[model samples]
Target: MSQHHISEVPVEQREIGMLAKHREHIIDQIDELVKRTKYLELLNECQRHGLLSPGMCQNIKEYTPGRRNENEEDLLLERHRQLFKKLTQRGPRAYETIISVLESLDCKEAANVLLSVDSGSFVSLREANKSRRPGMTVVDEGVTTEGLVLSKVSKESKYQYLNPNEPLVPYTKPVQNSKRIVKKSDKCHEDAVTGTYPMCSQYNRGVLFMVNIIDFPNPGVIRNGAFKDGEELIHLFREIGFTIFPYINLNKEQYMRILKELTSSQYVENTECFVMVLMTHGNRVNQIDRAEFHDGSIAMVQTEIIAHFQASNCRKLANKPKILMFPFCRGPEPDKGVETDGRSAASPKPTAQPKRNIPTLSDSLVCYASTEGFETLRDPDTGSWYIQKFCDVMAEYAHNTSFEDILKKTQSLVQNMRTATGHLQTGNYKNIGFNKKLYFNPGFYK
Candidate 1:
């Protein structure tokens, strides 16, 4: 006879069962019609924000205890539990309302009830509480994924948190000035409806411009691993709704020209988001190296690249999410085999230039594979550790999780990975200035 061992159940699961059992008691506290209306409204809001699919909404609408099969009903309830969990994490007012309703019904384990519904939701709920407003009404910030703060004022009439001294720029659509001459080249990009390729297709959620530089003038610095990175990214981004545009082996002039052209492309105007992936050799000063087949190697400063997409420059893509992924060496220093014997001699550094501000360069994210003055590792078979973990985590959680949350998880995953030589790779994320929670609608391309 085979012996079966019964393991101890998790505290969260037990709590969930307890909450489910007392679901009726909580329901009794709220007016049935009002509760139903609120639930429906929440679902609609979720749908509008790309958090829930049409099929998910339909499933909720048709939910009945015995009408559907047992398994189907269980799945439906599980989805409901997920929704409740997400609300707790990202919806401050809804979570507060749920907790208040439970407490009013004399449920002492209100926190347990929330944990039971969604195990990983406790941290999110705690974070939400930190920024909760005084009133009960939802205050949509209109930018971030963490939905409106609770307030007495209605959402439309509610004032945003702004500095009293700085003059505010009202969010408005861009209009063409009659006196300004429109250049023929400025009217770029093929018509989406008539475009044949996926990169130019109207159905795509966004454009992914990948620049891969493999062969350098120096044999030691040749990026044999870059092609693999491109392949991996293409597969990953496609699943997440990006139309991939791979530009490989471009010299310095060609790469710069292409980037400048893309900034003014009509495609940027139509796309919901923009992604730029750079897989190349770079320096500590944030300059990417390019192979000049005829002349030699040249460097392109990272700021010059980013400036092309600035608000004053690329008006069409202003305020939209711009994600830049750089999987390259920030410096020549290796991670391992450093000499601890003696103090190193200090060297004179180059003088830095004065910085100019671009106010419109908000809503951008820059992901660096390694920090300044360090070298990141790459796998010949797979790809860079950061990119691989980033794609994996994004593929699994991008649909429901906020980009910030997803990136945090990816950072954690990257930090946990160790190389064969026992050297660990660490990545850096710079949130340029995104106010809204960025997300790709699940099954958008499908």
Candidate 2:
């Protein structure tokens, strides 16, 4: 009977009711909770669930004006007290959010303390939130079994918040360069007829060139958990019948030299599609991005990377899909997003087809971590939200979905996410001159 303890209030209202009924007891336990809490990890979990309001997380991280001189641990405990109090005010949904976070973080003792705040039977945090999502068996507050499977079951970025004053490079019209060379898509028509970018198993070895920068010169700039993203990318892309060419921390000059090698006759002639992923800290001055490297923390301009693949430079890959995914900050502004419902959006109309008069940068899709002028978020534990979602979406959908649709799904998933303090981020893409239904028919060739 005790195990089956039931509440009189409606399911949606039970957690709130329980929380209110035990408010003081829960409040009393704050000291204990603070003592055991892993504050930063808890902060991330709260952000992941959007439990805290905009800027609340930041407020908790720093001391109020006069208290900066206090002992660090003492200040952190006080901060935890403030966070719990705020969550209590935010009502039961926030209560459920924190409880779930606690459980996921394996702080069971802390979790149970909140669950039984009144020293009486309390509503299960899992039971409280399950009514909202029918198919889900609420294991954690906001996370579902399905989510864990979708997230870990699939496996996936690393970055810091460095938003530069950058604009999304929209490809509205073909560049009018008289000196541009014309590479005909004549040879790519057969591949297009099949409806996906032709991916030959023979060319799988050169399929993706992942330049992951883990070791930065300065200790402050080193991306800690980003290596996880690289590992996942290799496994996921390789499963898609694409070969993975992973390059670790390289000097600034080595970046182009490697790309130049891949553009060698062996790769150039058999290449089906070109995929390049640049994971690093980006500093923007004007439209150019300074991608970091090891030896000197060398800076490389964003465009040169693209120019290296231009029809003029990499002739064979000009007509194929040239995908460049940058999981780094593009601007200095953090996106404090608006509240909105999830709705189906028609795939963003493709960039108007560039007149193939001379192989004008067609078929190039540049995916940025966030929208123009906004900072993107990254979890020091998992990876960049944008890259993680992108890989996850692809891992699930690439078999039959078009390239454009995949990007939209990735964008939607990334956009709906808000940070612990409620900052929003959006991933976006630019379609270069190439306009055709691109697919990576995983296992079809294998």
Candidate with best lDDT: 2
**Candidate-wise lDDT, in order:** 0.49, 0.57
lDDT of 2 by residue, 1-446 (tens): 12211122111111111234545666888888877788788876665555542233554565342565787767777777877764554333445556677888999899888777544443455555464432211111112211111221111123311111222111122211122121111122224454556654544523677777665433323444466666667666666656556766666677777777766555546767778898866644345555656553435445677667777887877667888887776644456566568776786654444353866466789878776555555544455677767777777666656778889988887776653344567788877755567767666553
Instruction: List CA RMSD, all candidates.
Output: 24.9, 15.6
Error of 2 at 74 (Å): 41
Clashes of each: 4, 12
Candidate 1 TM-score over all chains jointly: 0.48
Query: Could you tell me which 10 consecutive residues in candidate 1 have the lowest summed lDDT?
Result: 9-18
Candidate 1 deviant stretches above 4 angstroms: 1-204, 285-296, 336-358
